[model samples]
Target: MWKKTQPLSHEDIVAIYDVLLGRRPESESVIENYRRMGSAAAVVRAIGQSGEFAGRRMSSPFHHYHASFDAQEVMRRHAAPRLEPRDGHLTNFLGVVIHSKFLPGILGDRAGQVEDIPIPANWHADIAEWGAALRAVELARDSFTMAELGCGWGCWMNNTGVAARRLGLKPHLIGVEGDPGHIAFAREACASNGFAEDEVTLFHGIAAAAPGTALFPRQKTSGMEWGLEPIFNATEEERRRALAAGSHDELPMIPLDEVIGDRERLDLLHVDIQGGEADLVDSCIDVLSRRVAYMVIGTHSRQIEGRLMDSLLGAGWNLEMERPAIIRLSEGAPLTLVDGVQGWRNTAR
Candidate 1:
């Protein structure tokens, strides 16, 4: 009777069949629940908006996009001792103000990265997770050095150093930025944090790729925030809000190969240059291929998702673990960045 008196359209019929036959665990049951919940467009749209929606895509809707790459492919692309799931999350979100008043103005003339750094409890949770990861890598390696690419105001570097101290690890810290204002702020952060001279490096301009004419898009409509809007149509005001929270940008314009001497000696690398991962990765092909022990990247490129796994595989690296790039949402619901935490590593390295 149920099959004979169905009102579901041909498209819906085909979709249900596809989900039942070719999709995820308990696809038949999930589809049944969807049917019971009502086959309204609004329902589907709402479901699409939820973080659970992508999980469905990764399951049932995957056939439409990703050709089934086997477990070996998954391992070959994303398997390693990643930096941590919570890397730079707070820094990218709110490190500026936290480090702004605290950072020293006279940098390159100070000692350890910084002191007297403060963070809220919630923010500190993320900081703690990331800091612990950084320390683990630093302790495991010899002569640890880090480059904060596109580092604005040195907030990420400064907050990280302070957080590291809390975690009881002190590796060499550097702030690479093109903005003089941020460089000054970073210096202040360092001095305020009580960093001794020679312990911190501040590479002002021309990092890892972008040489001259560093362009920062006014902290509004940044690819980092705006690229996320399509799923939920985030406006420019939110960019302003994030900017107000201090997420300025100065992409690393030089190649790691050209700048750093040895890749093997490098420990943990933190990269947050808006959405410039493609160019950055392309330019630092050797570093991405050689050293790159632990990495945390925030990318919005659809192109990256399609080819990212393959790119890492070709470099002989594998994606070992990953998690959702959870973004705080307000207007309607929270938006969890789909392509999240693809950690790749090479054991043979």
Candidate 2:
């Protein structure tokens, strides 16, 4: 074991990178750079900021390991909170201010008080998503532009926008949501965070491969609804049955091209459209490769994740980070219990 007070040897530095970052150093010079840092703690701190470390944190099976690198601890060490939390409003580890009304069914009782919220826990989002989103913002030059597909309450949009703004870059946020009520919440979130009207634009529709109509759930209890995906290319009988069931609403399907519009470059594109994620991405791979700088996707199943890899890797995009979907045997078949996350960077751009 290496002592914290002593300078790490070359072997110790290599081991630390392998264990913490899941990879060896790029070159001997890289190891020498860490060696110059002297202490093991400094090396660990530097590794913690790396994209590989972020990926490893997301993919770790142990919850405690993930919690150790929580945003709260990171913020306390590096960046200070931009706004103080009040009774009805709370700031996350990233200094993004969120209103309590947006918490409701999401955070449950923890949303009641600002003090009750656990900053160390991944209550709303995982570390990989935060890392990928922030990495995109860090890569932005003059301005930061991002779009969130299936943007429930505009969570990623507001979170990333605030992060970019904190870095002194102007943010242009775009959000698309099938649920009208959720769109309203997203609008409220932007306003509550003090974003100018021109800085934020919201679309009330579904994001898909093509322009058409799809069936989306008209959720009665909007607060309790999540992971809702639109059903596309439904037959007449299926549409009739769905309408008769009184659960789904026919909504306009906005294609990726329309959603992208004339933006020169999008800093980030966050997608979490349930199981439809892979298909939507595959259909828009060409456009995405040219326009998007980075993507943080929510994967629902092993199959969806595989499809994404094939499509994106073929398109020359680099898989910067990934946390595979958690699969468990259920009645002699594999079923995904929790959603996985993947962060891709556009190498072509």
Candidate 3:
């Protein structure tokens, strides 16, 4: 339905190279070289054929042509462990090797698909998604505040830190997780990944509408995959009954404003609070409108997804991307609900 109007001018080609490479051409001679190549396509081929781009291992994952972001240095930092590059997956996963310079790395566990770690099956999709997220933050600001609610193992935090550092920005990162054990693990992971105490901070509480107690499912001793954990806004009697039954753990639920008091501006916020996304967004709409420039929230239900879409759009945030989850009800039944990550950027403010 759509087609290119005309060949891109030399200036246009150079601009594209600048955005993809994150830097201007070395000299005017580079532009002249591209000009001598004739068409835009030829210029692109000439650039790809150059030794500098060739050394970067130019790869066009979705196309036949090879393209490079000039991110070899960052990619080397995310080299797969020895156990990886095998048939299946690694038992002890360390970090993800994303080829996009926008996101340098993602520290996560391979035992289970915890964070966006590259796998033998979905490594390309993983790299594209994580890289897009980091690119969103990069476009929003060079240096600014960032926070991750439900910061599972601090994978996104590390990714943000690494990307920001490469961009010459010293960003302050905050990690908030309701899981006590996860909070400890996240702290250690952050420290191990070169984050100093002053550069990164951790909060051990669930982010809710207000400061109060919320019922969280206590992790079982054997497994740690509670990606669908929910926080209930239950009555005191209900809370007591759950505690008496020894099923749920009582955790302090604090609002984002309280935890991030007086931050002034939050450039980006990544929230994956399992099923609590809708309630948390509703409860902290004011704080979000005031401080947050961009938000990427993971939803678990159609109702939650609609609520978030309405609330953020009403507050002047624009939807940037959405990846919906699909699951079958039974062996032969149709998929029931759609839920996944939704990205929004505040375009008005």
lDDT for every model?
A: 0.42, 0.71, 0.56
Rank by lDDT (best first): 2, 3, 1
Clash count, one per candidate: 31, 0, 0
Model 1 TM-score, all chains together: 0.49
- Model 2 scores a C-alpha lDDT of 0.71
Q: Highest TM-score: give the candidate number.
A: 2
Residue-wise lDDT of candidate 2 within 83-162, one digit each (tens)?
46655666666555566565453333444233322221244554455665677777788899999998877888987888
How high is each candidate's TM-score? Answer: 0.49, 0.76, 0.62
List ranges where model 2 is wrong by over 4 Å: 1-79, 111-121
How well is each residue in 150-268 modelled by candidate 3, as lDDT tens digits?
A: 77566577666766665677778888776676676667666755678898888877777777777877655411332535456788888888899987888787678876768777877
Per-model root-mean-square deviation over C-alphas: 15.3, 13.8, 16.4
Backbone-clash count (model 3) = 0
